[model samples]
Target chain A: MSLDTRPPRQTPVRHVATPRERDEQRGLPTRSLLLALVLACITLMVVDRTSGEDSPVEPVRRVVGEVLGPAEAGVNAVLGPVLGLPEMLRTNDALREEIAAQDDEIAELRREAHQNPYDVARAEDLRALCAMATNTGYLLAPARFSGYSSAQSFSSTISIDAGADAGIRPDMTVVNGDGLVGRVLEVTSHTSTVLLIVDADSTVGGKLGESLESGFVDGRGGLADGDPLDLRLVDNTVLPEQGQQVVTWGSEGTGPYVAGIPIGEVSKVYEDIRAGTYRAVLEPYVDFTSLGDLAVVVPTGEDTRVIEPEACS
Target chain B: MRGNSRLVAALLIVVTALLVQVTVLPHLAWNGVVPDLVLLSVVGAALVTDPRFATLLGFGAGLLLDVAPPADHAAGRWALALLVVGYVVARLAHDYQAAQPGPQPASTPRPPYLLMLVAGAGGAFVGTSLFALTGLLLQDPAVGVGALLEVVLAAVAYDALVAAVAVPLVVWVFRREPAPRVAHVLR
Candidate 1:
């Protein structure tokens, strides 16, 4: 007994349950499922990015939109007025100045109304006639912004309640009381997505309000958070001064954005001597953050010659 | 195959949040920035759920958001970002719980607000920055770096503020049961 021939049987050391071990004990997540899902997402992204209006994901997207669009519309309609109250309360300096300007206009109107009532009324009638004549050149249909672009961080577009059902087609110009907001990107049956003028990819023919200098106004896509609109000058000889009003110069026909829609006011002018062009940063008239009622500009009638350029998907 | 009621409820909550985000958040935007409620919901769900479920939740929710109207980019950008966010959040919560050997006594403080903040900022940053990076990688430099910074800062700050309210609510709502002697702060 004192001299045991065999060494004591070694006791096995049990491994402590580490986190991974515990996790495994519970159950290992099926790796195939994760891989399949991830691959699916990536593939969808790549395909959708490449395929414009023809991705296989389009069906699924359409179905989701069809199922959810109406529900979103209903909720927005019911809660819109109530929710807009907060935004309505928050006013900026531009708004304050606008209010002041309106007050001055009202005062002038009041003075005119009191001093020469018949003359003012006659003048107003004449103005209304003139407006009707001017408006005859274009067909304008108003739509409300139903929802914003889903990815707020990167995208700048808004969905309108009106769409193909409302005679809306892609590439139509959208505007509000202020100025040019954007152009229609895509149109579903009852809803359409508008790519704003401030989107980086958007381009419109523009003219300076004062100098009449023409340029291709490109979007810096900063309208949402105050990134100014960029106007690429066609003429190297002219440089637009800051605060110079910018307006759309229409294409030959009913292009994406028609002519005469106010785009923005030049905020900064940078001349590229090599390129022989000046890029002007413009302060857009429309405050994109508070977009509500917008009108889509369509051709007066069925003259469908305005070709819709395919946007980068 | 995905018929868990909690998962359904979580998905419903996330979808509702996304709806509210697009509909009501614009009107509630301050300085052109709005909180990503869906991101917050992901953080909330991640805190209570496993990584697999959280990833799935993020992917599904993001796909819905991407395909929805007003989504200008590709269909799965948000999906990728949310997938990362959900996994990170679950890992954070899981690691923290695993690190704690035992539940503390009643006298000690249970400070979840700290974690809430980290989760919120991290999720917002990861989600948004990934979205922006995808744009850049696609050769679509829509906004300048300065503008992107503004958007990121605004989004991160706003989400952080909202997370205080959303994170605890989500965790409490989705959590199955409380560990014994571990008095949850979600109450």
Candidate 2:
């Protein structure tokens, strides 16, 4: 196409230097900035409160969680074999030793039983007692943990492989075969996060096995001198012994945590001079370091009530 | 050819490092302390790269760490913190004659590279401190001074060790300068 050669047309350019015009332009941006700040503050406040309340943003949280979950699983899978090699070797050795020792003990017990018929009766009674104390009747779902919160001094929470699909629900009590672990705080389709009993925020209402005294066991953050957990004896009447067995007191009206699950053994008991309360240090039944597999106790409505032997007599 | 491949390789390395940190690190933890492998990777990247790419690399690394499990703080917090670290290290690199100019610097003397070390340590300290602060603000009462210091120290020490090897390796992997040519006069 041929270029058109013509006189250039000039449109009149308007310039306004009025103080009022400048003021209006400046005012618009100032107002917009203020509005933005206000909106941001309000949004932050809402988010902050919602997270604290433990409200039902779980679906959204889970969506965000999905991005990380697979990568976490892959990492776990690859490292599983590598990390397990050492432990497998050690465990194999330990198992052999334990099996030999157990065989010797069984032979001795059999010999004693043969010598005295009363020894057989005594052994049967002891086995029954052990079974009752351990509560082997309860069905448990085992889970493998993936992640744990690293917020240095806060409540230590762990994310396990089992979740809602595995019949895990919020507030449901979690335990190892040995004792109480914690309650399920949040659950997704395929994963659940557990707030451990030793976490600062966790509180377990427990009873001393010997005296049947009841008190709350609160987690004091990882000990100052690297001592075990200090369980504050909240109840004045409840005096726990040094080697007392601690068991969970059923949920107060809420069906979250079940009763009679072993929590820990009282490692040490100290009398607070001023408070007149016993501060017992509980060594948790489930070792946090060796937490490879954990079981979640699914509550069956029928309460396995404990009958007092002394009362029956 | 090498430059493009090296960048891609670095990204892959970072992703793998983050994955290891989030899942495997917890299991490998000793006395509740796991090595901060992601921080080490970021420090390595920052040490080897130019100032322009520092922030981008840091943000990418931090984002990966934030998305990992056990992440309590908001997503962008670490990203912002690491960005600052990368910038500081890159700026410090400009003044140093110890490291030869290339995609990766050959073994630099220890003393002159102290600035980079300080930057890495300071970055980890600041990043971890911010994370702790975020926890506190979120009403996590358990976070105290002692715990904060412990994590900060651990992260700094771990990151420094990783940076030492990572910097050299990155430099070598991306070394693609044309070999010096010998000229012969026509007889």
Which candidate wins on lDDT?
1
Query: What is candidate 2's DockQ?
Result: 0.08
TM-score of chain B of each: 0.84, 0.68
| Residue range A250-278, candidate 2, lDDT tens digits | 87532366788888889887887897777
Across the candidates, what are chain A's individual TM-scores? 0.51, 0.50
Docking class of 1: acceptable
Clashing pairs in 1: none
Calculate DockQ per candidate and list them: 0.31, 0.08
lDDT per residue, candidate 1, B2-69, as tens digits?
Answer: 23666667878888888888887887688979898898899888776677788888888888788886
Model 2 alpha-carbon drift over 4 Å, by segment = A1-64, A87-99, A105-117, A120-313, B1-7, B97-122, B133-142, B161-187
